[model samples]
Target: MNADLIIAGAGPAGLFSAVQAAENNENKKIIILEKNSSAGKKLLISGSGQCNLTHAGDISQFFDHYGENYNFLMGPLYTFDNHQLMKFFKDRGIKFRKARGGKIFPESNKASDILNVLLKEAKARGIKIIYNTPVENVKYKTGRFKIKTADKIYKSKYFLLAAGGKSFPRTGSTGDGFQIASSLGHNIIEPQPALAPVIIKNYQFKMLSGISLKNKEVSLWRKENLIKSWSGDLLLTHQGLSGPGIINYSRYMQKGDIIKVMLLNYSKEELENNLLKKIEREGKLNLLNLLIKFPIAQRLIEKILEIAEIDGSQNAAHLTRQERKEIIEIFSNLEFKIKSLANFNQSMVTKGGIDLSEINPQNMESRIISNFFAAGEVLDIDGDTGGYNLQAAFSTAFLAGSELKERL
Candidate 1:
């Protein structure tokens, strides 16, 4: 089999590129090869099936959401931004609703709606999607590309490797793109799980699994030095720590790194002074009762007391100065050592992929090999949660598709 352009994977990147390429130059014969039996398996489960397509804000804000490769994605994101992507779907009669943190989702709250629209558009433009066909190998020979599947070797004049990274292995994004791109002389940065929950060492909050803390600062530390910090809602899971606060920065975390959760918004001195004044005013009040008055959950305060080896039944008058100092320290800083990040199956995205140096950001084309392009998680780009990843995929796919007409 042969075509003008052969796109690997039918995720957001491949499907969006096929639609855009078909629209760019009619009768170009674009085809998308998907390993899954259907399209957008990962997408279908995104945002718990709500499919937050993009963020509802100025495109400039998107730059900070992507980590180190924000500079590389500037051109593509600027070209077809969140507004343009929203307009594209709105034009198809899809209604949208904005959720917290500027997350834009379909009003119907169904990820299938987003997938169905893309499929409809693809079908409308005669862009064929061949499912259950995973490319085993990719080769360029004599100005033509050869893609090998289990039973056949297909050829195309141009190729797009958007097979995605190994985040969800069951969803067909099992790092096939890395192997394919590596075979075609592209370097792949070793892929690791991103936006994954972390298992904590000696986690003492086992019973506090469902507890959530809002608007807290979580700082990452490497020994005596502070590495990085993020602020968001944090959840204590049965496994360990999770939520946007931890998961967003989990890419930079390694086993044995320490994470400090700022449970209280107070300095050591400030809390101590306030507690001293309160103890003076209410000397007979229970120490646990005094601590609970400072905007912390009762259960968390009790756990902290337990960890600090202080009896909650002790009155403020009976609380020794040493016990007071220990409680204050625990209240201000709760430290946990990371055991490990969740595996690829549990990760929301993959952190690293094909090295970005060989790919041109202008049109998502390979600088080393002409007519070979890539987009989405297959590259060394992972965005924070809340529609950034999907937006990156669409923007890069659009950039690739908009320039495919020139190659044709």
Candidate 2:
């Protein structure tokens, strides 16, 4: 083998993997091949550039954020969990701060600082990283894997495939690794757009194009059937809708499915109770005026009233019980016809990657191809925003680096 280790991609996972290998193994020759001119381009924009490096909490909590199959990360978490990762950064002079929701951002609040630290550490440990060199193919035969770049070919005793997914294409995650993994004996889970925003039905969303709802609950209904619900800040976009709430439900969205939205997020009976209280508290207010309690624009309130058949000019005190009941219904369950999803520009992260079943979770190594490990968004694992994905990248890379070094 020309090199002991050759890691693909230079995002969070690949950079960290190369760093760890170089840091702990002084005797081995480690090389990282990055397609970008510099390392960690996509990483530089994570956490809105503050770079949520890792989470600061129990391993179970970390596992909880990953999804239903938390066990897929048990080995990785134990090997390089948040505590260990934080310590790793601290030792390298990269200070970090704990943000809301267990997220830990760099104290400098510049993702570049995090990337700089990792790159510097790798360079200091005698690791050679070549940039602007895209890997054309990876061919495995005779118990060895061969990697070919544009200008050169290299063979490594061990390989870590950390190329990212197709989200945020400019970040260098183009989903090329998925095809390469499939060419080997791995099965892909049919990658789809995940963590993207939803386009609400034109009827209800057209009026409130720029309004925002904060701390309000949001529910996703598919054809009158409530599929999922999430609550956070909601942003009215130029096209339709976005926000933490809708983005959370995007994981379950399928093609040809229409997702409905409920702005009030109040239960059927709770709707009735809140409506009556509004009438009792402000009897002289008009129906359009009463809707100010919800976080929409007054003009939007008027439009909603028009939809509900409530007289915008009529006094709340004169509202009939039936009118109030209908108003409550509209507020409680505002149907949004889900048209489609926002593209890569609107998404925070990509959902699907390499099928998890094809890789050994313990070391992120491909089961069919010896010494070929996979990590980060390139694998069939993705998490929500607020630093979850960064943590996954770091954890899986840590495991792959350390575990692969053991056999050497």
- What local distance difference test score does each model get? 0.91, 0.77
- lDDT per residue for candidate 1 within 28-76, as digits (tens), equals 7888999999999999999998998999989998898888889998999
- Which candidate wins on TM-score? 1
How high a TM-score does candidate 2 get?
0.92
Compose the digit string of candidate 2's lDDT tens values, residues 339-370: 77777766777777777877788888877877
Clashing pairs in 2: 201-337
Question: On a 0 to 1 TM-score scale, where does candidate 1 land against the true structure?
Answer: 0.98
TM-score of each: 0.98, 0.92
RMSD of each: 1.0, 2.3
Using lDDT as the measure, the top candidate is 1
